[model samples]
Target: MAARVRRTTRHSSRFAAGSILIAAATFLPGAESAADAPGLEVPVDYTCRFPSGSHAMTAVITGSIPADGTAGRPVEPRDIALALELPAPAVAELAGLGAGSVSARADLTVVHTLGDETATANWSGLSASAQGITGQEQVTLHAEGSVPTATFGSAGTATLSASDLTLFLSPLQEDGSPTEPAAIEVECGLTDGSDGTLATVVVAEAEGEGEGEGAEAEPEKPVENGGTAEPEEAAPGAPRIEGRLPAGAREKLEAARQDVEALADGPDPCPFPPIPLPTPADTYVAGYTNVEKMDGAALLGPAHLNVTLMKEYIPDPCTSTFKVLSEAEFEYGGRRQLPPAQGTFLTYGFMPTTATMELIQVGGPAQIESVSVTSDPAMPEYTTVTAEFDLRIRDVEVNGVPLDVGAGCHTVKPIKQTLHAFGTGNPPSGYTVNRGGSMDGETYIPAFTGCGADEDVSSLLTSSISGGGNYIKITQAPLCVLNDTASVDCPAKKPTPER
Candidate 1:
């Protein structure tokens, strides 16, 4: 039997009670407060998906924490209610096990930033109510539980998907060794304890069941632990768990893990350092960022724009006018709100796109006001994100040609154009926005390079920026995933995926 949970410091290295038995010990990540700013309140909208042939569940994410910019607080789930649906075959198999009906009870990890590392808390309020036997059995599951109120060590976010949710039963260690602490045993009698009957699942030991065909049929394992149910052995490699799993249940488990839906937007988030311009609000939202430096020491291609400073006359500069803080990645496919600007400035040749940005870099305060992300009708599996941005670049250095605003030849007027960019995201993150074609059309200061009298760079801006067909592709420098909030070697996704 698992020991009763002993609540410890919120920043402790281990989980409570039954979780302790599993040894899910993790380190806490910390969040730095940005000017006692009001905590961020990000709305949650997520969906939990199972691999092919399984089902999906949707939930909302809500959180709060004080920071200067976007991300800076622990995100708590207002609730986590889901219905686990099984495939028809699994249902049929359940009937064979003499079980007229079955239900699933699993846990989802509430992920958040703690101290200086990623921390996870196991949430297990999953409840299931019998939905009347419809067809035959494998294991048609349903959940009717809610998440408990909790907080992370620091202010941040968390997300739930099949990969990040659902409890895994270990029958053995990765090296095929017996799992530590051993598996728990329970007896599922033929009748409920009441009525003078006790029906509880029991763990049965047997000779190893080889992996190939002609192998003994896997048992019919029902989802373990529902509302009020105690922890049961579920991890696959542990020691063959005796449950409601059907013969060949191993394949079934692997299959379910494959087809997961991107999570819905909640409080969960990730990366990128903000432009260094001083700002008011000190809040920073979590998400991913990918920055690529130009070969000729400029910002070009990858994100769909080529910026090479007129080196002979000026210096190389790079900048992006797309701000998508509150936007959803692979999860919710559609429009989203931009992160509020804590501090924005219109800098020139003076700042680097990232802390490590060395080549040509330049840009001013810009916003993505609003964006629309959808899937391609043809591929359906791919995500398509489009932005309507307004640019207000004041004196951007090109090839070192000083953006002399009122100068005769280089009468560079601030750029204020509405350019459109669309790109296909690689599976997970859902973004590969670029320059001119259907994919890489960046904004170019065409028609007039120097001065122009019309511009509106307000809350956000969008414009196709490029080096006037000078998509000078060259050997570039390695990308960097710099992060100041976490300890050295901490994970990063901003500007790019931090290794």
Candidate 2:
């Protein structure tokens, strides 16, 4: 037997009491009929307006649904679909912003379903399109969703009403700006007809003058004293350098050059060094580590160099990329600071989701037109980090070999390296960069180092470290190029005066 339903409240009385009092009728079983069983309904004849020359729009829908418990089936799913017609084909432009196709008959589906028994609605599948219209764009919207099947025991007349529905259209630009549309309309209805009511709300276009002025005026270009003029050329002998180096060592140098270029440009590149190297206790920055130890020896090998190389060679970090940036901090003297040292290092376990590169132009002893680098967030077992830097070559030499240079044209010589020292202690095996107070028989320093490069410059004044170890302090000396007669000092730092 279809359950014996009875209406506890009279629809006439409820309607007389006012729309807000409808909730009191939920308990009344046969009081309302299926057609009149207050279900989803859209406001009668609605309309939305868009200002002239704008892409934004405001829509208002009015209607009502049966109060909680009033109908046989209390729950219902509803949605609103919108379709925009444009005079001309504009789908390509609108699609770029995730809008529907631009054709004479474009349809935009904007769905909304009620949450809980409260009749509260939420917008879903909301999208726009530009396809067919005579001269401008016209937006059309309608409500849709499932309806209740059970009917109210033939007592109160089936009620069909809706609450107010409003919609605002905006663009998803980086700046979060919205463009006003030329026109807008809204409609509402129910998808199912089981027990609930279906209502239709249609908004007609306003006939009067549209809101706002159409489109923004074009800005006038500034005129020079006589007419548009070109920029002056760089002064002669300005050390305008531009060039490219050979593939091998030149790659590493080029990577370093790109880092310098980033610093020279506005946005700050990673403040941390390209590769984390070990540092002496007296100058050690906190939180950074160059080594990890296992048992009494280096965790990976004699110098921890093997482990660092293995980790660095891994293509991906095993952990989430987001966490790697924060982990770069190192602890020193109970406080955190940037490590003070430079050299190749490797870190294990890293993962990155996105990589971005920006081209920059810097004028100095040499003018650089572009710089690029790749960064991945640190991950576990995947913590390796690889960075490459490129510079516009005015002049460059790798191992005393000269390179080619030109404008708009440049060469890339990368400085490839890795970082691995992440734990707290003298790496079990290699040397220690910073030796903290000894603990038991093991030394606890917060850093480690690894040596890597095609050429072994370890014998030269340029020191090459192979594995973990205690932080070593080396005096900062001017770098000089070797000539047959004598050694000439190479400029290590760019002078501020020129900058």
Candidate 3:
């Protein structure tokens, strides 16, 4: 959330966790949300509290959404738009930090100086960034995708979850010198679930050698002040700049990754039925692509190969609308004639399903609000989309053991899915700023009675991906596989970040 600021006095001194300057702030609902507002309109108002009183904070969002995903059209490139300004005095003081830049290094080591004494800390392995702070009225900061001024456009609330968010500031350093990096970097986390939004404000010296001394910097948890100074109160739902994610985030993700993989390449073969892509009526993100590939399954002892692909159109912001281009590129080959069971598809190729996702960031963390199976009678492609699992199953004997998989062999229960399970963006893709999710429908085997839970077929799917700014980075990625098109490779594990 907020950086643990250590408030120091006008006279510089060795800095501790809680020995930095303090500022108080608050927010008041200035106006009601324009529920009837036809098109997307963003309104931001916040003030940073100082020692005396509150200052006015305001920002403006200007951009257009296109209509690329309207019908069955192609995607186009888009960019985020935002403008913000800090108080004039803060701007002036920051400007006074003579000749230095604001910087956040990959592995940063700094020697804090307050008059004479100093301490060192190593902020390494992790990355952070911030931008848009030059003594000016407003600065341009692009936030790849679009955000909702009102929740689902009806709740009459705001998510403020712009694909990329920037905080303007005139950061200062000791001795009135600018920090080395010179810019504020911005990074957001979809893995944070509802409140995944975080920022690391880098406003200190990049490298400092104690006066007339030479020594290495070591990591240490600077002690806090004896609860003397207090931070300013934040607006009702202001996004916090948490330096790092919560503990066990990696562990939870690893567990999800292992489980999904088993389900994908398990006995059930296909856990995620082919779901319909979103249409123009849906909320659209700038650049989106999802690929899930699996192999090895013996349904009736016939070897099969399956791959599912999902993609969203990219277009200029103004006219663009949310829409998905989906395909079930599953291939079931081999002439080994296997006995067919009831309710099982003879090459059932994608039994049919559809998905709807919402990206949100308000009242909580920035995250994928909801991902549910939906149906559209007007479009028969996704008639089977539902939160309840209905993955088509079959009745047969595996290894000479008879198993029950529903009458028609269709799965119907709670479909299991995991978001941010593999970290950053979707697993396999692991695209930074891009959110990822997967579904592994549970398999049911008759427990000598009726259909009982067996195991799940892991699914490699990305229900949603947001924020790439103007530049789009497609890893050794794949496109939707259609008829006559060959399927692309989807790694069983998350890919390393593209250097």
Name the candidate that leads on TM-score.
Answer: 3
Could you give the C-alpha RMSD of every candidate to the true structure, in order shown?
A: 26.5, 30.7, 24.7
Model 2 lowest lDDT segment of ten: 301-310
- Candidate 3 lDDT over 1-499, as tens digits, reads 1111222221111222221211110111221222322233454554444323445544344443231111111111122244444455544444555422222212222222222222222222221223334545433323222221110101111112222222322233533333543333322212223331111111222133222232222222334553222123322222111111212334544554454356446554422333454321111112212211111122111112122323333221221112233222111233211123122211123332222212111121112222111221111111011122223433343334554434433322322222232222210111122232221222222112223346322121211111111111112112222342222111111112111
Each candidate: what lDDT?
0.25, 0.23, 0.25
lDDT of 1 by residue, 82-187 (tens): 4444445434433333443333345544443322233234444253433333453433344544332223221222222222344221122233222342211111
Ranking by lDDT: 1, 3, 2
Model 3 regions lying over 4 Å from their true place: 1-44, 50-53, 63-80, 99-256, 259-421, 424-499
Q: Model 1: residues >4 Å from true position, as ranges?
A: 1-75, 114-116, 134-140, 150-499
Q: Is candidate 2 or candidate 3 better by lDDT?
A: 3
For candidate 1, give the lDDT of residue 202: 17
lDDT per residue as tens, model 2, 1-499:
1111121111111111011111211122333323333433332322222222223222333223333223122222223333323212232334344444221111222221221111112222233322222233443533322222112111122333333333323322232222233113333232223222244222111234243312222222233332221112322111011101111222333444554445557443333223332221111111112222211111110010001111111111221111122112223234332212222222121211111111121221111011112241111111222223221212322234432322332223322223222111111111112111111111123211111234322222112112334221111112222221122112111110000
Listed in order, each prediction's TM-score against the native is: 0.22, 0.19, 0.23
**Using alpha carbons, what is the TM-score of model 1?**
0.22
TM-score of 2: 0.19
Clashes of 2: 118
Candidate 1 contains a number of clashing pairs equal to 128
| Comparing 1 and 3 on TM-score, the stronger one | 3
